[model samples]
Target: MIEQKVIINLTDENSNNLGTLTVSSIDCKNCNESRVRISNSLELINIPVVDSADNLTPIQYCPDIGANFANLMFLEETEYQILFESSDACASYDVLYSLTKLNENYFKQFRFSLGDNKTYKIAGTLNFRSYVGKSFLDIRKNKINSIKIPIEVRSKKMDYFNQYSSMIADLSHHALSLIFEVNSPLYQEFELDSKEKKTYYEDFMFLEYLFRNENLPSIFEYLSKNIHSQLKNRTEQVPLSLASNFNQNSLKNIVSKPNNLYKYDADFEIVHKLKGHIPQMIEQTKHDDTIDIPENRFVKYFFESIRDLIEKLLLSSDEGYIKDKLLFFSNEIEYYLSSNFFKQISPMDYVPFNSQILQKKEGYREIFKYFLMMEFSFRLSWDEINNQFKGFEKKLSELYEYWCYFRLLKVLNDLSITKVDFDDVFKVKKDNWSVSIKKGENSVKKFKFILYDNEIEVELFYNLRFSKNSKYESYSLAFKPDYTLLVKIGEHINYIHFDAKYRSELEIADYYNVFGKSDKKLNEEIDKRDSLEEKESIFKDGDIYKMHTYKDSILKTEGAYVLYPGNKTEQFFESDMIIPSVGAFSLTPGNDGVDENNLENFIREVLKTLLFKHGLINLNWKSLDK
Candidate 1:
């Protein structure tokens, strides 16, 4: 095994050394160069491994170190300079250093000269102010030696994994529950043991069900109370004189064969046939109570299966918060496993059928039903979504968009907006009956809202695309908004556009400077900016500009809004007209509950304005009569 010493020095913005990390390289083949054949085209591509030392020296790249390698940890929104030094570097080698953000596909390469004309040393500054995840750093010295190191970036404000995961969980639960309630054909053909085509969605849904139903605790409690036991029969060799129920068989065996008889306490006995037995013995039948029933075995099997699944998920997960969350779940599962009841029961190879005990017993019945329903419940995948968006490495941008859509739907539903049908939103594929929700402009959901005896129709669109090629296109350039809402009353129509921004902050002036302010007042405010300390802004200015474009270009657009995970909401109006407005609303996933009051209120206000403007509701009415 070829071993190499690698030293990494981490420094902050002030050039103060934060810490140092020492990493060791492991040996592997094809480390210098490798060929990869594309699966689709079957075309071979030669990938040259950049080496930092001699061209003849083999490189030892460690790709199996996992996503969140402990050797490299960084805090979000922090700037740090990293210096890489390797003992195997040659004096004449020129180093090429590359850094790539795997999630965003951002790459930067730098060339380094020999450090002090002695060893190969490369340094770079990484600014993790925008996003957080795993990034790869590749150091190569011509054809000599190359090493790839994995870096983990983490958020300093909140638990990134838990927050995003919670959002996705809530959104998926709502969507999947709707699918289940409507009896989608996705659940028709269920196979329990077909593990080849499973996704993380299935794993999450199963875990959610178990936690939501409190199945584990309930099963434990029920088994503790109504402990099930069964009579087990066993046969043992004993003295023929002492055998109680060994009537005909024992007596015939002892009397027919004289050699079988032996001297006993006071009577003749059968001779022992095996070691560790009395001198003369006979077969005896014995009955005893055992808790190792099939039902108990099933319980053990369920717990062990769930524990293994959780452990697998933990290993595969790259997010620290998710690993911690999974650890908590694993601990909860261990509570059931450590119980004496389960310890006494043996493991089961196959799931048992629903027998009388499984069906009739209170505790056993519920768990058994859950076990049977597990495969059917989560087997369906989101067929319309891309495969990349289905697993743990799901894009937060796409997830936030979906979460915003579902959250808006929930808000509308909470406000008494009745959906027309699920036909457009949910469809079953003809090939496999897998459920798919139509995305983009092809999918539209209609709802009806009645206020003051006026029936108003509303349409919701997810990822609505406006194309210049269309005959009825309103925008000069093609654009796709995350969500679009259309309200219709008689001949009047209004369109409201919303874009989900996964940012946690936005740049904005005070209310007076942004809304209902003249150009002169804004100019005066800008002039005084030098004296006023500016607030740190993480939101992109282009997002606000995009909202303006949506409002200005899209015909009949009453409002264009940005939904972000922030704590403040701001709205900007065009002149004095409420119809032409641009704004951003705070719509974030809450640790306790969803923080959507601002968005909800804004949506309600929009509906009220539309109803009032269309003469559907009385102007004097303070609120809609629910």
Candidate 2:
């Protein structure tokens, strides 16, 4: 007698497990097994009975695990498989698709009960794939839509997510390191006023915590501080004065009589003759050197300047988070200055870069230099600051496109299928897909790469202006695509364009509808919709429509797609086969790397088709599958 058990892992379109099933050896052998189903309503039906047949292993059955099975999530077909062994032979099936949902807008609600009678609502897409007992399904909580597709595509999109998450971490670490290296000397200069200096130290640590993804210690306390406050404590150490020597009645420091009346104090402290009403004297008058105590005098100003510069150079744009930080530091500095501890520092109190005052106060020389560097060194204006902050997303989007380009390059390099002929390969390679990871500051406004050999030519353009010269003059407006790839093989050429979209699902859904309430209220609306409509798209119509316009209007274009941060099950979409089409690639990241994504497979498939079509490779194309 052989004893066996079968377990079916039920998952959604994104391959998130809805439930798990275990059956006995008798159920495995039964050819006409009872059908199990999970509807879009998340209702579980006809679950297999536990221990109907003899149990070989001391395995628990449905009575133990399936008692609370009503809460299983559902999107599409509930797939399962059989696993059994006898003395003679063992057997397994590829995949069994049983349960399914037919409606797209049907309501699906799965109640997951935690301890203490607490339950949570989860939104997900439906996905199906081959089962090999290896955990390939990884699902993330939906922030937009909940309709899942096949598992292979979902896995591919997960790859993009991993790559992006890793890149963001690297950039943040770089920023944090730069902040510490540039601001340490400036911090030490304020050692005379330790009370105020400590506030700066706290602010720096808070920024560090933000980078580390730790909870902020005092968020409300930090934001409540005033940014633009007046300085109060100050003293006039050196009084400014004026002097005169040739006055009659103002003879205060005269020790000798005048030698000549005409040539008064020129020749003689010795007297020759005294003229009528002649009185030789030196007079001096004093005045207070008053100043308004400039707003940018605190050590916090130094930190804010550095941060602003870093954001200007690297980040896409600050979402007023930096302003809140500035407020915290400004309030702390104002408090410190209001006290009797530190001397009031006016704008004139700041020593010039090469002033002899630096020689006298050597301790404050570094401090002066730090100030000069912060204010005068970069000369960044308010307009520039605003521009940099607003353009932060553009930079990040461009970086993602570059990441994709480099990944492709790596794959090509590994295959030894490409001989890259960069634009300036002969001299210095000026026009190429290049990344300048500069420390402290960096600029890449106009950057791109061009590749060519004897057979194939590839142009990877970044932020290429869509003007009349490029034949993209549709609306007489300036439009620059994030990334454009133009490939040429002999006489045949193909253009595939890509645009990086760093939008969340909620954002995409909101884009579909013009007017909306506050994000908080809109979120409530989205949650309610998720329970009702399981298969509806959470994507914005504009995003896909823009891609369609790109492919249709842009000259020499074959296809256009948007690479976004969505967790959709299907990695790619195509509306038409013959005409150029548009689609999207959900590349948002999760914690770990992709488990079994098909992004690589899809790229390979596309490449193989193009290679064969252009006669670049001459082999049995079908054999490439092997």
Candidate 3:
């Protein structure tokens, strides 16, 4: 008999059950029947035969599992073949409509519980296909609407997710990965809109962190570190041909000058454009603008002394020692800049790449403050502060030239040790989408930065390093997830890793295996990292947060999500969240929240670096208080 315990008996013909037998079933190969619906029925007889009025037992109650039974889960009509009739065999099978598969990549699964049923037949299995290829995020197609006009053109927005497990991931990584795993394919076979494709592009940038999805882990190397945070992948496309159809010249124009394509610049674009200029010019200009800043003299002097620091770092340490020093500088500078800022400047002022101010800290501070305050007053006096502030302004900005070099240095450092894979392919209308990935005539300001020390020699070294060793198609796949947060509730803690989720659900075996585990299982993986760094960095504090991405809704499952940093969010998300933010990095920056590429090795390196240099950078990247 088939049951919650196990299937015991199988026979090719129903007549073989002369009386009744209960045996354990283990081998499928030896079974003679193609498939059989075994029954485990417990009987209730008439001891007194009563209705509720008198409290007597009913007559002959041998119940068959009905709709209220596990029957609803078994959409296959023949699932209750024996209960329906012994000789009934339908010519075709019923489309097991409501059966939902788990939202996974390689380990895709479909399941329905025996909610109230007792007996059910195993139906035929369907071949594998992508849900991304089948659904759309339609506002008009309400849940009440049905595609009854089957003969008419049948189109759909992809189902970004596969199932409705009550988990609303809070971290960007978990959220992005969910969407990434759930995103459906946009193919030439379907007739989709230009806007939809544009939405896809925008989502790709924010969620998957990839501007283009022609291939997995595509090189977005030419993009700037500044633009990395806010480069919107908002390109619209109507499919005409495959990727080859994308005008290379158009792309070149797109990369060289994205400003020409858009209607207006948001905070992100302004930063990207300003940073695109020569590092020297950009920083000098920024410095001049911030002359009135409280620590102006200190900052300027720091900039002046940047060269020595770079030399010290370069000479004192080669490839191995640079990471910690870099992290220290990256953290210290960012904290100092963001924390101490009296006023918010343009996006250009927030570049994370800059040289270290290694020596004579006090003198540098004095010089910087004097020049900064003096410049502030000078700029304020002018009616308009455009081209009028050239000459000395340019020279002042020259002090910051080293940041460009540092930005390049970071990119090269990223490239030198990291390995990424783009085995997967995404087919969609080709369009020009760009970022600071450092490819296709990408520029410094476009992919540049501003160091706190603001030194030229350091800038020069970074510039030379990147210009020489780095590819223009700079590893676009390198996504710096806005943040990695850890949240705790009830019995478990969730590590929310954020990244971009570009494509919908494909084949993700590992993702399913990891996310599907219970609380006990999740802790095991955390404790058993292959490296101490991964163990400490990833599990103890936090790691690169690649948010899970999704395809809104599709067949089988309604809303599905997959986490890139499939740590522990799987345990509590929807089960607790009454309403959750679907936006990527909703907890931090770039909150679009869905798409999918977070490099595996890149994640490891992030954890390793973060743990190795705990004191170097200041961040809340730590594990939940479990």
Clashes of each: 7, 22, 132
Which tens-of-lDDT digit does each residue in 506-613 have in candidate 3? Answer: 222245445555677665764454244222211111221122232111111111222222122321133222112222211111222221112223223333333323
What overall lDDT goes with each candidate model? 0.58, 0.36, 0.23
Q: What would the per-residue lDDT of candidate 1 be over residues 192-289, giving only the tens digit for each residue?
A: 66655445555655575465424567667768878889999987777655777766665565556556554534332332342223336676678999
**Model 2 agreement with the true structure over 1-626: per-residue lDDT tens digits:** 22333334445466544443332332122233344433432222233344321211122123332221212211111223222111111211112222122222212223342213232223322222211011122222232122322111111122322443354443333322322333322222322221322112223323333332221223212322422234343322121123332344234323343431233343434334332323323333334442233323433344344455444332332222233334444444445445321243342445233544343443233334444433321211112112222211112343444444444333343433544332211111123211132111111112222212234555555555665554444344455666665666567767666677643344455454554546778667766665333333334445766677677666667677666544552323343222245666654433233411334454444455556656666755565562
Which candidate leads in TM-score? 1
> Worst lDDT window (10 residues) for model 2?
130-139
Each candidate: RMSD to true structure?
Answer: 13.3, 22.9, 30.8
TM-score of each: 0.63, 0.32, 0.19
In model 1, state the lDDT of residue 387: 42
Q: Which ranking of candidates, highest TM-score first?
A: 1, 2, 3
After aligning candidate 3 to the native by TM-score, how far in Å is the CA of 115 from where it should be? 20
Error of 1 at 427 (Å): 6.0
Query: How does candidate 3 fare on TM-score?
Result: 0.19
TM-score: model 1 vs. ground truth: 0.63
